[model samples]
Target: MSWFGFGFNAFGQISGRDRDGNDGDTSIVYTPTEIKCHVDEKSEKSSELRASWSRRASLHLNGGRSLCLAGSNSPSGICDTGCTDAVVGESFVILVFPDRFESWDLDSDEKIPIWSMDVKTLCDGAGSPFNLPLIPGGYIAMTPPFYRPLSPHLKATRLALGAKHSVLLSASGAVYTWGLGSHGQLGHGSLSSEGQPKVVEALWGMRMIFVATGGWHTACISDGGDLYVWGWNESGQLGLPSRAVRKAPKYQTSEETVVTDLPTCGAQPEGEKDTQVFISIQSFPALVDITPSSELKTVGCGSRHTAAVTRAGDLYTWGWGQYGQLGYETSRSDEPYLVEFFRERQLRVVDVTCGAWNTFVSVVKKEVATS
Candidate 1:
């Protein structure tokens, strides 16, 4: 398994070291650069890249003996020999084991755990992970000392968090979103904040197998391999035309810029054929066609970009690419751009994970191994 990274690297998060083992030499990686995943043994059962604001971890599930590949200032307790999984945040890290869980504060040289939980208490109070609450029609979230009971209990199958919003996927393939909707990241057809989890009416019948959210947008892959995107299109992260990418961009210099009033409501403005509808914020889910023939297997979204791997063993990227996060050796795009580098090298992308300002992709030789 090989790893490649690109985009912001001011802190050596993408690459642990420069040519001279110095972090000051490279501030931004403008292309796909291979990064080492330090491992004691190659017996991992599965792996994932967990990213926070400034740092990232390459976590390996080695038959319950978890290992973390991290950079400077990572919590020491995260590498516990018996760890099963971990959740990395901006200021803390939570290590989960079979018997218990431990939370550690970042940059704490003392190496003391700030929070911990016994597996029995958790499974008994919350549910399986922590089943103490016993909320009849709801679920509980382990937020350290308190149990944040999420309402409705929609049989959620997966959850994706964004900068200020959250997206939940139900077992029935329905998508729900809440939180900051000023930029229309909720896919609710309106720029209104939802106090509770509200189902995205636009995708009512579609059976989505996957959902993702980051920065100011949300994306999901339908069962038919179609991609639907919504939320802020400021950087063309939705793979749609945006006024922000125009030569003479309109709007303001602050983050309060709300994008609305365009001709993208399933129709065109009565004008010329070449007329472009530059959208800033898409409050509803819009189907994005990327190579009408190929089917997308999975997708990943960064703060200002998006990436996806097709079943044909190919990678496609779009949106903000100022730091080469798009992996196509370009700065940005309003449409999906295929990354030919992997094809030329005969590599097949299997999985992808996007950080706040960077992207990491895992791949293997396109040809099957006969040895």
Candidate 2:
């Protein structure tokens, strides 16, 4: 799949610059632009666009395919082959091989000989801050010899961790959340923290297929492709109404398609249909509408932004754009809007991944429909 990236690239991470063979380019990509895989080390698998603080990496089933585009890792023998899985964090990178796992510190460029063991595969935990090996009780400084699974079995299909909260999607299409919920991210219609994994009652009975958590927000997708978001909207990350977004400078709207709405989380007070419910924080899972004619294919979240691909191959983004993480180069957006770069180029977006401050998309040429 073709790749396009936009947002923070201070260290050439998103640009993949030097290795990408482009010089004299700025660090931040103001808009969605094409980017090529420029691994210093050869990888057997296709590139999986990933971004971390001041760096970028591409991983595959082989593990740690390319930790850093032009950084060191080749000298180490573990990544050469036989690695089964990998996990990337803000400050370091970890690779899990059948016989051992190695950790690398990106900041110090230190080669740390970590745990050694023969393992089959690493279970994915979340979308960003990359996925770490998780245990029943999180916040552990180290991995225990034998970890315990969730009590009485959770039968979870996916697990996502936010800054202070955790979200779980059960195999039965139910969404469960626990930990910090002061921001209404738990979607229980309140800001009360849940001691145990509590099912989001507001979304009960809906067959949710996917779930994600941001810094203080939670989002999910129903099997039928409806998108639901909640929690903090301080920066409009929830796609709900935002005061910051409404105050965006006029320049940001000069030539962009900006969608604006009353700050409401899909509610109308009794006999107040015309009265918009101003919402700076969504206390429950609020249904968000993007592509009217089609359903969402997939969705992802950044630290303060959200993105999704529609079944019709269109990409939409909302929330913080100070670093251009929204892909539209606007300051901030309270509602979802198309990333016109792809539409103007006739590229059809199929997938998207959000970093702490960057966004990556997988695309292909749009199929031409004819009589």
Candidate 3:
């Protein structure tokens, strides 16, 4: 399968080409470029194969049965292989960093991949070797022993990470988040950082099946095909009404008057009194009411923007667009505007991936019939 990348290529991560040896070149890639992979021509691309990116990129094959990592040196030894060696097996839990790599099989929780002192030299400032014990019901610190078993009642189906935050979607259709919350990205109705995963109580009773995080924002889709968003909105990335505009004179357009009658989570305030509040930072997940009423299929997020594909094969983007990442000529937006680029060509967007400051989308061209 082919890959594409954009933004931050100083380490040769985006180009997927050798960077004149180990010390990569110092150039930035502003547009999408096809990334070269070392896969054999015999291997077929399956929908089960997918990739996720942090500062580096990690490819998860067949739902974590096998894995490959790319980019500069990382804490997880996976990067040390430089995408050469693929870790194969479902019993393993892998955690990678820029300079270190760590893994553990369910049978042996103490198996440490061999590496030098750079990444494994110190842990939590005590000069402890990088060691992780994948045991159940244990206290976990940020560094070593990073993996911990969840409650018996919870079974995670997917996990996603932002720059400094994380999202977990459970098989039971529950959503949990943890990590940096300075920008109210945790969606807990408060901007407090969490060390452990916490359920987003504000979305109680709602069944969320998918979750994605941007630099400082979070987005998720409900089982009923609705979209909910919260967190940073500096550039209107959350697609919510601006704080300034909500406080201004309320001009009820004919369309707005009609949408007000719809039954949505954000339509009415909760609690003792019905006090209308102007929210600048959405500390809680609020349902986004997009027009034309369509069920959402999938969602993705960049550092400052978000994207989603609808059941009707339409693509929508919002937030920072200074680099045209939002597929629009405008610089920024707070609304989920539809992008007609692929629709005009009869191509259906099947998947999307986002980098630190770029967006990548995969489309399937519809077959034409000849009479």
lDDT of 3 by residue, 1-371 (tens): 33444444543455532223333333444434455432333433322222333233434232222233344333243322221112222233344433444554434434465222124323343221322211223222233345445565556666666767877777778888899987778988777899988998877788898888888889999988899998877667788755433443355343332221111225444341333333447788888866668889889888888888887777788887765567656677778888777777777777777755556666667668889
Best by TM-score: 1
lDDT of 1: 0.73
Model 1: per-residue Cα lDDT over 242-299, one tens digit each:
7666643344445333334442346554443334457877889999999979888889
Tell me, by lDDT, which candidate is best: 1
TM-score, model 1 to reference: 0.83
Per-residue lDDT of model 2, residues 52-115, tens digit only: 4455555543334333332233233333344444545555556655444566554563455443
Question: How accurate locally is residue 61 in candidate 2, as Cα lDDT from 0 to 100?
Answer: 37
Candidate 3 TM-score over all chains jointly: 0.63
Candidate RMSDs in Å, in order, are 5.5, 6.7, 10.4
Error of 2 at 292 (Å): 1.6
Ranked candidates (TM-score, high to low): 1, 2, 3
Of 1 and 3, the candidate ranking higher by lDDT: 1
Off by over 4 Å in 3: 1-143, 242-279, 369-371
Residue 269: error of model 1 in Å?
A: 4.4
